[model samples]
Structures are given as C-alpha cells and as structure tokens.
Target: MRPPVEVCVFLLSLLAPGVLYTLNNVPALQEPLPILGIGMVVLGSLLLLLLFIVRHKTTLDPLFYVFAEFSFTCLVGLTNALEQDGFISNFMGFYLKKGEPHLSTAYAVMMSYWEGVVHFVLFLTMIRRMFTRKSYRSLGLLWAGSSIAHQLVHVPGVVIGKYGSSLRPAFWRNVPFFLVPFWAAFLLFSRPRETPIVTADKIASEQKKSLLSRPVDLLLSLLLLGAAAFSAFRGFVVLDCPLDTCFTYIYQYEPYLKDPVGFPRVMMLAYLFYALPLLAVMLCGLNTPGCSWMLDWTLFFAGAMAQAQWCHIGASLHSRTPFTYRVPADKWWPVIGLNVLLAAAPALLALRCHARPAYFMKPVPKGEANHKKKKN
Candidate 1:
C-alpha cells in the first residue's frame, strides 16, 4: 500500500517557507490586508487538500488536519526567526509589521525559535508515533502544555501591550492558537492513560523513603522552593510592590518585567498563579506516596517552564527590547542563571517521575496483590 495521505501532506507542506519567501516580493501582498487574505488562502488550500484525500478513501486519524496545518507553521516559524535575526530579510517582515506587530519583540523571536526548532521536532516525533501505532499520550501532553502556555501569554500580551492599538486584520489568525491547545489537551486527557507496570512491593519500598534519603528528590525540592520564591518575588515586582527589594530587583535585575509590551509581566504572574502552586503540589507529591498524578503533571509543567523561560530570556536580552528594559549588564548572569534553573527543575523532576515511576505509583492493596499473583 502507498504511504498515508498525512505523509504526502507533510512533504508538500515543506514548500511553505519557500513559497512565502517568493511571495514577500509580490506587490499585491504588500498591504496589511494581504495577511488576512493569505490566511484565507492557506485555509482554503488545507481544505482542498483534505477534501482531495477524503475523495481518495484514505482514513484520517483524529487531528490529522491539525497536524498538517502545524507542519506548515513549523517551517514558517523557522523563517520568522531567521527574518527577525537579520539572517534572512523580508520573509516575515509583512507579518511582523501588520499581522502581529508584537512578534517584532525580542520575546517573540525567542518564542519563534522554540516553536521552530523544539516544537517542530516534537510535531515530527508525534507524527511518527501516531503512524507507528505507539502510545504518544505523554508527548501529546507536553506539546499541549507548551502550546497552551504560549497562547495564554502571547494573546494577552498583544491585547494589553503597545501593539494593542495597532492590531490588524491578520491578528485574528491567533484564534486557533488559543483554542487548539485546550481542545488537544481535552482530547489527550480523555484518553485512558497507560499505567506503569510495577509491583506493590516496589512502590512501597520507593515511597517509604524520606526526602533526605533520595538525594535527587531533595535537590529538586530545594530548587522548586527557590523557583516558587522567585515566582512570588517577580509577581510582586510586577504588581508594584512597595518593598525596597522588589523595587531594586525590578530596576536593576530584570527591568524587562516592566516593559510596555507586557509579555514578561504576564509570564511572571502566570508562574505565580499556576506554576507556583503546582510546584508546591509536586513537592508534596515528592514526599507523599500514591500521588500518581505527578507523572503526567510534571511533564506538562516541564514543557510550560521550558517555553516560558525561553521566551522570557530571549525578550530580556533581545536588542529589540529597550536598553532600560533589558537586564542590566552587571546582573545578567544572576538573572539568566536563575531562569535557567527554573526551566531545568521541572525537566529534571519530569525525568525522575518517568525514570522510576514506582515511587509515584498507587500502591496495590495486599489482597489485590495476592489475587493478581495467584491469577498469574
């Protein structure tokens, strides 16, 4: 049998960047309205492609069209980052200028890189997993969390930032960015999770250990505490906390939090409201037995942290940001180092949760264990 239609669409979608590059010079698309027109054209093309495949009697897996659409965006993201960095010119200039002007910011550039490089690889891997008939739930959750984090901050940032007044017809294209992740998360979470196979004896033995006994867990707990504290500090800083430390840190350490673009401030608050509490719960999960939720949630948080930190750091240092808002030269390492650690903590925690999941596994009752053993 021939390869699936998805495989063909994937190959065809690689033409997006080149096509866009050629279109950049087209005078017809020079105006702001062309962005909306371009969006419509893309939508039409995708619909046509889908209809063609259906006519050929190919079975489409759930989210087949979504994946096809994202395949095109992956290449576009690379082009966006390249155009922003000046390695390529005019590729996304029109989009940046009128489509979503906020994308010209340093934070958006870094986010573009994440979406281009990291998320592109993830989409490819997920596609491979789907075609291979493997369980991709864990990977799906990671992508969902990361994509949701981007939309949550980005959409709001644009609405409140200086760009809010300048939003063009093309800006509405972000509607899918906001809706798809939540929908994907809903779908992924609704699927029955594949349970980790581990014995009750192993679960008990692992969970019985104290925090001090597990050196890695202890380290992660301390780091989580530090991250939580940092989140609170930044959250306060953004809220105009009257304290001297908050004032000093905002002006001297990370003035990016005060940028009129509003992305950094929103990101800090998100960490405080969502990530901080989750970290506390995860810390508890580290200490408490039978917190099976840690396995998936940890991965989700890791993806969010990774995406948020990447954008935050890039925005903080990007030349596009005003000098006053960028990290002070004297305080660069401390700010970046802390952010790096924040990104790393969740990743390490996720790995630990997956590596030896028995610690987090729900303990089987003695009777249940005996019955299962007898049946075996």
Candidate 2:
C-alpha cells in the first residue's frame, strides 16, 4: 500500500533540495546565494504544486511532522558535511573558519563525520515510522531532545562567531531548524498518554519498596544531581564568575570553560535546565508509582544528555577551544570518564523505564475514552 499523501509530499520536499543542488552545478549561477535561491525557488514551487494536488488526500499525523523535522535535520547535517569537504565551502564554511582559534577543526571534522552517519540512521528511522506504522516513542523523544540540544549550541555559535546580525540570510535559514524540532517536541508532548501493562508481580514489587530505596538507584540519582550542579556552575564560570581559586583552576585546566562567545555557554545553560528538572523529577519520581509522564521525561533526558555530552566532549578535547581550557593530560582519564558517564546515565534511565514500563504507566482518562467512543 502507498504511504499517506502528507508522507509522500514530505519525502518529495526532501528530495527536491538535492535535485536543485545538482541542477545549480551549471555554469551560470555557481555562486552560493544564486544557487541557493534557485534551489529554494524550485523546492517552494514543488511543494506548492504537491500541496495543491494532495489537498484532498492529505491526512494529519502530528508524529509524522516530528519525524519529518528529524529527516530534515539529517539533511542539514549532510549539507554541513559537504560544506566541510569544500563542496559548498563559500556558503557553509564561514562559521567553521571564524571559529578557528576559538573552535577546534579536529572537532568539526569529527562532528561532520559523526553527523553523516547519524543522519542516515535517523532518516531510516523516519522511513520506518512512515511506512511500517510502528511506534518508537522513546526513540522519537530522543531525536527531538537531541535536535533541540544541537540547535541550542548551533544558533548561538553562529550568531556570536561570524553570522553576526540576525538580519543575515545565514542566520535566518537556521531558525527553521530550531523551530521545527521544538514544534515536533511540543506535538509529541501533547499526545495522549498511554498505560503500560501492569501485572500482579509488578504491583507486589511496587508495594515492597520505593524505587529510590535501591542502593544503585540512589547512587545514580546523586551522581546525576552532582553533574547537574557542575554544569550550572561551569555555565556561571563561562559568564564570568569571580575568579576565585576553583574558578581559576577551571579556567586554566578546563579551558573550554573560557569560551569567549556564548556558544558552549548557551549549551551549558540548556544542559543545566534539562539536568536540574531531570534530577528533581527522577528523585521524586522514583517513589511516585505509575506517573505516566515518567517515560516521556526519561526519553527526553536521555536524548538531551546524549547530545550535550557529545558536544561537550568534542568541544573540550577536539581542536576548537583555546588551548588554555584543554584538560590537563594527568587528569584525562578522570575527566573523560566522567563525561562518558554523564552521557550514559540518561540512556540507562530510558532503558530502565522501557524495561519495567508498568512502573510508569497511567490509565487513559475516562473523558478521553468517552470522547473516542462518541466519535466512533
């Protein structure tokens, strides 16, 4: 069977850019803006025509929009890789060049390679959701969270580095990347909550002890809280906290902390916000039986933490940040290990939530069921 009209149109919209990019390889309009304009115009025309043709056939699926946004994000990431490879250097490499002494070239190259692989996987995930009609709620939330985190860094990184004023096309084009993912997240959040299967054994276990009462759970919670505190403190340091001994040590030893512009600074703020609420929710949440939102929150945090850690580790150890902030060689093991742990914590939480999902399930509200019945 064919996919829905909305799905087909969205897929075409994705392919349109590549066709335009290839067509613009002609001799007349090789320059970035002219080529970009031609591509946008063609893409716009195609979408308009498709919308007209499919107006009656189109079906609404809010989740599909989220997947579509992710697919686009992957395309953007691939385009970034091309820019790094000098295929679209003029239009894309400005920020990479400007970030030289401040940002790491090694990091950028690695990030490009990483994005190329990741975007492909994400695109496949979208295809699966579209054609197979399967639910990947946890994965969906992770994609949304990571997209949001990446933008949190990227938007500021561009504005502060070379993009300058918000008026520039360079700056404005990126706005959609941020907006679409956030809208996707909101759509996912608004969906009706579901109840996981609850068995007699699960109920008995819940009555036995609080989730946090376990030693491992308590340890993980405290560690997560500590990491959140450190993130907030480091963000403060980036914003020019008074240079006391500890701050001096951070600036000297953990040099990325001294990012002149607010790129890493802004990212840290995003991480801090996610981490703080996450830590609080997890702490209180472990004890509260069957809070349906637990699964959603876990998935979101897992995605955010994974992306934030990726950015952090890359920014710290890779080529961009000033040499002063580089982690001292002697401390490498401890520092690197902690960052990896930070990334791993949320993934573990998401897995745990998924495995024993009944702990976090919530019953469908009577009103919603009644409405569904009436509609049927």
For 1-376, candidate 2 gives per-residue lDDT tens digits of 6566446645654673465355434546554455446545754666466556445645745555445444543554566556555566443333333222222233344445444456446645655665556665556677777777777776666566433443233234566667887887887687765544454455446546664566656666777676666666766766667859447746555666555545666666666666767767776676676676778888887877777777678768754455666687777787788778878877887777777776555544556655665776
Clashes in candidate 1: how many?
A: 0
TM-score versus the correct structure, for each prediction: 0.93, 0.76
**Could you tell me how far off, in angstroms, the CA of residue 348 lies in candidate 2 after the best superposition?**
1.3
Name the lDDT value of residue 267 in candidate 2.
66
lDDT of 1 by residue, 34-96 (tens): 878877798678768766765764565576567667767777877887888898886776677
The TM-score obtained by model 1 is 0.93
Highest-TM-score candidate: 1
